[model samples]
Target: MEVLKERFGQIGSQSVYSFTLKNDEEMEVTVINYGCIITRINVPDADGMIENIVLGHDTLDEYVNDPYFLGAVVGRVAGRIKGGSFELEGQSFTLAQNDNTNHLHGGLKGFGKVVWDAKVMEDGVLFSYLSRDGEEGYPGNLYIEVTYRLTNDNELSIHYRAQSDQKTLLTATNHSYFNLSGNLKRDVLNHSLHLKSSRVLELDKEFLPTGRIMEVNDTPFDFTKGGTVKRGAESDYPQNVLVGQGYDHPYILDKNHDHEIVLKDPESGRTLTVESDEPAVVVYSGNSLKAEGDFRGVPSRKYLGICLETQAYPDSIHHPNFPSMVLEKGEMYSSVTRYKFGIED
Candidate 1:
């Protein structure tokens, strides 16, 4: 394994650096300190040809100006907080309602928009950030560390660790639009996806979780068995229509298997397996990707890529039945999510 670092660009008065991690199989992953964003992931196709699969921007300016979370570490709280208000320890705290009437992806300026202190390790890069008390209407001084590692076995591992000085709500995940086909012009509708989830979190008209966990037994949201992205989207099922165009809702992961999700691009014979400790995974079909110019310098259309965001349930703080996202004072918070890349035999 080898690690290389270079100056990426300038964010305000701070200089951003990009670190590249290469393994023996010729797999390379590049990440920038700005938002600890993953800039590239070059892996081999069925024909042994290398291709970049993750969607992102070319320069720091594009990332700074881009609204889509593309390739960045998102959080403080990854999903929605209904009404932008939550009660913790008898205190009611209101957050910024950036997504319609709900608080989405932390706030207006989330962790994805901030610069992190980065350090290069033997086989990975470590990023650290300090979120002060009341930074985004949260009540704690949170210290976070996220590490991205490329293992020799062809797995891109992300490990997140955080601690709060005061009790606070915290959940985070990486938002990377992936196109396993290695063709940016094409949509991921043809790719086959299999999720180890029997139920999905139902959402309201506002796209906030309704605290209802509905079974995906016969619905379009069912991916318990492998299915194409287009088939799932084209189903006139009420849940499909309720979420707008495509799959933007979270699937409650079954904890029975080590691999919670598997995505395959039959054209390129490339496959991706997602294994995470998180309770749920939000499978976003890139319904809102209308990019004038993307990382490849081409116009991007909807469904050009997909995001399998592994994190805790959205709006879990308000639902007592859902797993708690609360981090008590003096308690360590840790989570791990891995994306393993491979080619079909």
Candidate 2:
């Protein structure tokens, strides 16, 4: 572990920090303090060359105000809340509903805007943030901690722990746009993708679930085995098209002890395998990405990075069938997701 560089010094009352962590394989991980973001991750290609795969800005200001989700830790609650409200035990509570009719990513003052307290741990760093009751219209006083462990084995393990004084909804996930092939300007349509799921929640135009959990079998949403994203994206598949011409639905994976999502960079031969204990994962392709002008990505243009976010289903509080997101008093909430990086032999 080493401090390669500090991204920002002091901007008025705000302070930001960025440090680099190198493992035995020479894989480098740059983490930022603001929002506990992962600024960059440089890994080796098949031929033993290094390149940054995660999308990000060169300056801290770009991330501070960036709506791209870039590399920030997202929560209080990760996905969307239907109608910006939920009914729990006959009690109805309304939320800010930042996303049109839904409450997306914890509203306007989400975890992305808050600064996290940082500590240099043995192998990586730990970022912590506290959410007060009614902050962004959420309930309970919540204490959350996220640990980013960049291991020598080229694995980035994210561990989440939270506790609340009162029972409240809590689900946290890191929103890092990943383009493993180092092509940020180009779209990720050609990348090979595999998800360990057979059924998934269908979504409406607003990206909210349509209250139906359908099977991915014989549908374009099927990525049960490895397949390209554009295969079904171009078809008339109902859910695939509604997912904004890409992948943005939460797949209910099979209950096995294996990895859930595996992405292989055909050009670079860099493979990223994701395994999580979470019940479902939201696979969102960068459909809204624009690469026309100066705001393009690294080597590729728009829609290059894809996000595989591990968490409970969206609007879980309202869906009794989905796993519970409520953190009761005296009870601890713990979840773990790991990304193992390697090159194809």
Candidate 3:
């Protein structure tokens, strides 16, 4: 383990620090203290050329103020809440209304905006944060610990552990936008995407789940067999058009606890395989990126990088049919997700 030297002076007044950890195979990862963000991950392609596959700005100030959710850890609760409210047992609760008619990404101040305490160990780096009761209009005083481990075997593993003082929902994940080709200038539409999900949690016009777990068999939402992201995106796919752009719904993965979704850029020979223990994954195609700003990506228009967010189903707190996201007093809630990189010949 070596402490990464801070060469760039723009890390800001937030006491930024970087750590490098090498796994058994000799791969290296650079992690920063601010937002507990993974600043850079260097991996080899088919030609043995190492490249940084994740998108990010050069300074802490950009992430500190950016609302794009780029490469940042999300949640107290990761997805949307219908009507920005939910009932627990028999009590009705109102959440912060960041979205016009719903609660989006834990309201105005999410875990992404908070600075986390960092600790460097021989294996990797650990970042911790504590959310007070009703911090974002949610119950429970939640304590969260997230660990990032970069292994020599080409895997960037993330472990999430949380504990709540009261009964409250928990769904946390890292929102990393990846363009594996190392070309920020190109759209990811050419990349082939394969999901292990047979069904998707249907969402309404506003992107909230309709509480129905619809089968993806005959629908365009089916990515189970693998296909280019743009295949159904241009067709008359009902879910496609309903999402307002590309993917933004939570696909119910069909793996036995730990399954993977793979994406490969044939041109760049870069591949990304995401494996997780979390029950569901939210596949968002950066549809909201076209909002107009410097954050509009390098060259391509909208639908550039694809997001595979592993977590509990969206609006789980409001849906009784969905798996429980509840963390009762003294109970520990934990999950793991990994992004493994390699080249396909």
Candidate 4:
């Protein structure tokens, strides 16, 4: 394995770097210091053709202003927090309500939008950022570390670690929009996906969890057996139609199941298997993607890609039954998620 760094772009006079982690097998994953964003994941297909799989921009300025979150790490809290407020340790805290009445993806400027201090490693790169005590309304000076490693087995693993001076809410995940069709040749509608989840949290009209867990028995939301993504993206079911035209719900992860999620581009014979320790995953069908000028010239439309964000359920603090999102002071918070790539037989 080799790690190479290059100039990405800049925010003012500060220089952002892009680190490429390449294995002997011709798999290369490029990540940038700004937002610890994954700019590219070049892998070989069945025919031995290598191409980039994840959605990204052509330049750094595009990423700095991107609203889609593209291939960045999202945090402080991974998803929506109701009304951008929470009570902790007998105190009340208010956050920036960027998403209507709720807070989405941390706040106006979350981890995905900040430049992280980076260190090059023998096998990968480590990105660290210190979130100030009052930054984005969180009550902690949180130290975050995100490591991206690529091994000879064609596995790209993201390991997250964090510690804070004050107890705070933190759930981090990589928000890479994947379209395994190589160079954006097609949308993800034809891709077959299987998520080992039997239940998904019900959401309100505002897209916040309604505190109810709904079973994914027969609806298009059920990917327990595996099926085409189009089945859900184009379904007329109420939940399918409720959130745009596709899915944006968090599915409870069945911990005992093998291969928590699997995505395949049948035409390219490319398969991606995801394994993670998080209790839930937000399977976004890219229902809100609407860019056409930045994606290496590919016309971006709805369902252009998909996001498998493995983390504790968003807004878990409000739902007593969901997994906890609190990271105590001096307590270690760590989680690992692996994405293994291969050619489907």
Candidate 5:
């Protein structure tokens, strides 16, 4: 294993640094302190050729100006919070409404837009940030740490730890648009997706959870048995019509003792297995991703990549049946999500 650091750029007055971690399998991951964003991920394909499979910008300036979240760590809350207000312990707190009429991904300037204090490890990098109390209308001084590790076995592990001075809501996940074909120009619609989830959170027209948990057995949202992304997207189901573009709903994962989801690109023979302790995984098919700049010299387009974001259910604060997103004082919050990459035999 090897670790290398380079000056990425300056975000405001803060100097951003990029840390590169390479393992024996020739897999390399570069992460920048700014938003703890993953700048690149290089892995070998079927032909033994290594290429970056994750969507990312060429420079720090592009990332700063990008809105798609690209390859950054999403936080405070990973998904939508309806109305941008939630009552906690008799107090009603309202957050910044950044996504239409809802509060999306923490707030206007969430964790993804902030600089974190980074520490290089032998096989990974640890990023720490302190979210001040009342920042973005939250109710606590929260301390968060996110560690990205690349193991020799071709696994990228993301570990999160957080604590708040007061009761607050917290959920975090990595928003990495993956194109296993190693070609950003090619859409991921042809990729085979298998999710170990039997149900999904129903959403309204605005993309907020409708407080309904529907079964995926006979719906287009079903990926229990595995199928191509295009097959699901082309289904004439009502949910598909409501979502319009592709899979953006959060699937309720089955209780499994192994990885919850698998995505494979037959062209490159590359497979990605996602395992997480979280209760749900939001499979976003990059429906609205039309970035202005080039991604590694390739033009960015819609459906070119997909995001399997593992975290708590969206709007969990309002749904009592869903797993809680509350982080109380003196309690340690921890979660783990891993992505293992390999070529199918």
Candidate 6:
């Protein structure tokens, strides 16, 4: 096992650095302090061919100009908040309407656009950031820490911890777009996906949760038996069209299953299993992806990559029956999500 660090770039007066953590199994995970972004993950296929499995850019300039969030941590609140405002403790608060009429991904420069303090851990890296009370129109001076670790067992684990000085809404998640075919050889439409979820939070036309839970029994959202992602991406279902002809809904996780979620590439025999403590996982099929120039990923197009964002239900603060995302003042907030990589054959 080894950990190496190098200067990545500069964000204002802050110096950005990238840390690479390697395991004895030939797995390497590189993370940068800028937005606590995962820059790279090199792992092997069934044929012993090691390649990068996640979408990323070649330089910091592309990262700074990226609108997709790429492979960074998103949030004071990960998803969209209704109408860019919410009531908290009998007080009305308004946030930046970056995503048209709603506050999307913590108002323009969310956690994904900030520079975090980095520390090298024994087998990983710890990235910490402090969000001022009024930063992004949130009412809390919060200190958060996210740890990224690569275990010898070929698991890339992420753990989050935080505490706020005042009550606030918070549901953070890592937004890593993964294309398991490795080296971007093909799109994810053919990647087999099996999700241990039977219900998904319904979304309205504006892509906001409608406080309704929809079943996946006979719909394109169904992934219980495991199949190619093409069903949802290529389907013209109303729900699918509501979000650029693909999935962008949060599926309520069924913890009763042993493996919560599994994504496999049949051709390369590369597999990724996701397990999280969060109640739901927002699966985005890269529905609206497009890029101007070449980068570490493939030619920009829809269904090129997919994101398995593990977090609390979106707009949970607006729905009484949903799981609460409020982190009380001085109370510790902790969550964990693990992504294990391996070969099926």
- Per-candidate local distance difference test: 0.89, 0.80, 0.78, 0.91, 0.89, 0.91
- Candidate 2 regions off by >4 Å? 1-11, 183-185, 292-302
TM-score of each: 0.98, 0.94, 0.92, 0.98, 0.98, 0.98
RMSD of 6: 1.1
lDDT of model 2 at position 215? 84
User: How does model 3 fare in lDDT?
Assistant: 0.78
- Tens digit per residue, CA lDDT, model 4, 1-345: 999999988888788999999999999999999988999999999999999999998799889878898899998898899989999978999998899879988899899998899999999999999999999999989999999999999999999999999999999999999999998999999999988889999888888899999999978888999999899777899888888888899999986336989999999999999999899999999998876554888887888889999989989988888889999999999999999999998
Tell me which of candidates 2 and 5 scores higher on TM-score.
5
**lDDT digits (tens) for residues 148-173 of candidate 3:** 87765678889999999889888888
Q: What is the lDDT of residue 53 in candidate 5?
A: 90
Q: Determine which window of 10 residues in candidate 3 has minimal summed lDDT.
A: 3-12
Best by lDDT: 4
Q: Output the worst ten-in-a-row residue range by lDDT, candidate 5.
A: 287-296
Q: Give the Å shift of residue 57 in candidate 6.
A: 0.7
lDDT of 1 by residue, 104-175 (tens): 888887799888999899999999999999987898899999999999999999999999999999999999
Go through the candidates in order and give the clash count of each: 0, 6, 2, 0, 0, 0
- lDDT digits (tens) for residues 96-204 of candidate 5: 9999878988888799999999999999999999999998889999999999999999999999999998999999999999999885647899999998999899888
Off by over 4 Å in 1: none
RMSD of every candidate to native, in Å, equals: 1.2, 1.9, 2.4, 1.1, 1.2, 1.1
